[model samples]
Target: MRDPVLKHRARGMRMVPTDAERHLWQYLRNGQLGGWRFRRQHPIPPYILDFVCLEVCLAVEVDGGQHADSGYDEARTAFLKSRGWRVLRFWNNDVLRNPEGVAASVLEALGGVRRADTCPHPDPPPLGGGGN
Candidate 1:
């Protein structure tokens, strides 16, 4: 149920990313951050996430001054949350000037768990018929 138009737009966005996006991509690409794969300019239908880790259902957004107090962004965040995605937002300046801090926050939201070692479900049901 993917939207083709949004997918095309996302592809175009990836071709010419903003300065902050470009810089942040260096840290997020190729499982560089926490060994978790992140897709840049990823489409989630009706919106394009700046970056998303599908494994953890986490979305990261970097915003410029134009987004200050934006009603649209608020709505978008609400929608994404309703769909079970954890959203983290950072100012463009912060990403450019303090990437380490931003990355730390993202990692913290990710529960500081490395992707390969982390289990999707921490507790599993026992396999046998109990006390038969």
Candidate 2:
């Protein structure tokens, strides 16, 4: 269970996402990409993640130009990483202009299963079917 205060704040954050967040959410929302459900502006105590795919233990942050060399973001990344969550950061323009590339990178990070219907190849026909 999450704290009520944090949950409230996360809800507000969801309602007022940045344009870059909105753009990226288009691909991340509703399990659209890789069938991985992502929560936006999700709070994980002490910090709010821009987008999180809990199934893969991955957190993604979308940053504006002001975030260049931001120590705060660095600390947040460290904290999340310490908790066994991999962090991925993308610039605002990056998500806005190149959403496909962003989604592809995310899929790669999640081990690249494009959709539920598509899957990695299974082992081939047991080589020779045990026949002489």
Write candidate 2's Cα lDDT for 9-83 as tens digits: 989999999999999999999999877899898778778889988776788999999999999998988977777
Cα-based lDDT for every prediction: 0.83, 0.82
Clashing pairs in 2: none
Top-scoring candidate (lDDT): 1
Off by over 4 Å in 1: 112-132
lDDT assessment of candidate 1? 0.83
- Per-residue alpha-carbon lDDT of candidate 1 for residues 3-25, written as tens digits (9 for 90 to 100): 77998999999999999999888
Model 2 misplaced regions, further than 4 Å? 112-132
Best by TM-score: 1
